[model samples]
Target: MSIKSTKIFNSKQGMLIEGNSLELLESDENLSDLKGKVNLIITSPPFPLNQKKKYGNEKGEEYKNWFTKLAPIFSELLADDGSLVIEIGNAWEPERPVQSLLHLECLLGMVKHPDANLRLIQEFICYNPSKLPSPAQWVTVNRLRTVDSYTHVWWIAKNDFPKADNSKVLRPYSKSMEQLLKRQSYNSGKRPSEHQISEGGFLKDNGGSIAHNFFEMEALDEKRDVRLPHSVLSFSNTNSNDYFLKTCREKGITPHPARMSGGLVNFFIQFLTDEGDLVLDPFSGSNTTGYCAEKLNRKWVSFEIKEDYIEQACIRFSDPILKSPLKKMKA
Candidate 1:
């Protein structure tokens, strides 16, 4: 209930709170004024799995109930046109080859919650092609299944078409498309689909192409990468040489193992929120959401149960990004 105990870091643009999110939301005075004020809520909460992870996870019915309880609070925290995006990984039955339906059940439970009027806007698959094969029995030893490469990212909101701009996160034109842009003409006609394409146009360049839900990136490095239509979100599963790791090693801090993809978060931040909008991540592991949100010039608040990861996420503030188009932050 006390504001002094939970407040950790308070900068000009953001603040980090250290405590249970339920308590912080229900009682902490410092965060009290923010009820129903956040423009974007992005988090990758611990998944429900047969095996427990060091980062923490619930399984089966417990996981469903736990996640469902938070839905109403999340709805209460969003502004009228705001959006909430959660990235939840899949789970497999213990020693079984088949995947668990807990994730899907949890999603349905949240959607059906009486107090939460959230709509399932879209589902994104964060394709991590480089992830190692799991369920050693089924995926490696018996070799019955392939590597588990993608996780589900639910983009939910009160409105089906919540505040979003495709133009904000468009990808660059491919070489073939660039040549066509110069020509300034397109052959438009109706064919196999039976839908007519008006013959007069298709000449204007709408900047870059509207990005598809699928996303992929080679690694954690921030250089812009090509996006393929088939992939919603893609990035290297584990990055060893990033500055965040370097800082953690120097400080003798163990990095959070299950971190959200940097590239994935960057796209949503640009697509969903404008500069100076507020972004909140209630289950922030290593607070990657906070780091990315602040970098994009948005006001942010992050709540983490672990003090160690919260401390480490602060290091991101001082790290330099090369060739960044983001507004320069004053020293």
Candidate 2:
């Protein structure tokens, strides 16, 4: 379709469109054809920070109004079985040690809106164990509160049963489960909870174990049995020498301050959409959603208001001058 965007950078499986996401998505001149075509819309928009940063954000109730307004637009763009995944960070009250409930309010506003009429499917915690402490005065100096290190990831959809396959994101079997499978035997009896444990249920090897939504620190801890996958995704965004950062630094372009992790994008994309399905990232900060979508063979489109961020994001698709670790991007 003839999308009237400011600039377009084409990749193998997707293109980055530079423009205001809200304006571009709401455009009747072109975006009319996009309705009911997108299988997934995963994005990490600017958080409602107490004070504005270089990227952009609105505070207090104003942020709620600004954000919830996109609900109808997103609802219209998604297919009947399409899913929407959003990652929002925690916000604190201005000049106070107290936390704000703006994040939860925004989430509720989206699903409860009559025009949007969306269903809340599931919630995830994107944990960064290596994340730097935030609200420094409260956490570091005053010691009044602990460090805030997790963001909320909400998954919603137009239909209750959106397109999803948990088997696709299953984790490897635990050591105990593996040993049980090898032994091919177990006590078949009732447990204290009045639940029956059948040998047949534990015998068959389903390749891997089913993962739960509550991710624990033990998953990352070596002392414990690491489950393959969970809702509390733990990863560090402290990579200073990665290809994207290196390129940006070399070119003197400041990288998007709040770039979402590639792993977070990959998980939701693989779980929610399949190959050739269309994905959209309205915020497109550093285009992590688009980059991950392209690698997974999904058709994608990214919208960003800032041209400079888009320029830096292009480095993700292009060849790097340095021998970086991301071989898939090169491939």
Every candidate's lDDT:
0.77, 0.80
Candidate 1's TM-score: 0.89
| Residue-level lDDT for 229 in candidate 1 | 27
Candidate 2 C-alpha lDDT tens digits along 47-76? 999888888888999999988998999999
The number of the candidate with the highest lDDT is 2
Compute the lDDT for candidate 2. 0.80
The TM-scores, one per candidate, come to: 0.89, 0.91
lDDT of 1 by residue, 1-331 (tens): 2354444666557777777887778776767688789999999999886778887888888889999998899998999899999999888877678888888888998888999999899998776766767766788899899888778999999877789987887777777778878986677788689978775455678877888776654433456446542222333437667778888889888888788887788788889989999999998878777777766788988888887777767666557772222222222
Best-matching candidate per TM-score? 2
Q: Against the hidden true structure, what lDDT does model 1 obtain?
A: 0.77
Which 10 successive residues of model 1 have the least lDDT summed?
322-331
- The reply for model 1, stretches above 4 Å from the true place, is 1-7, 219-225, 228-237, 320-331
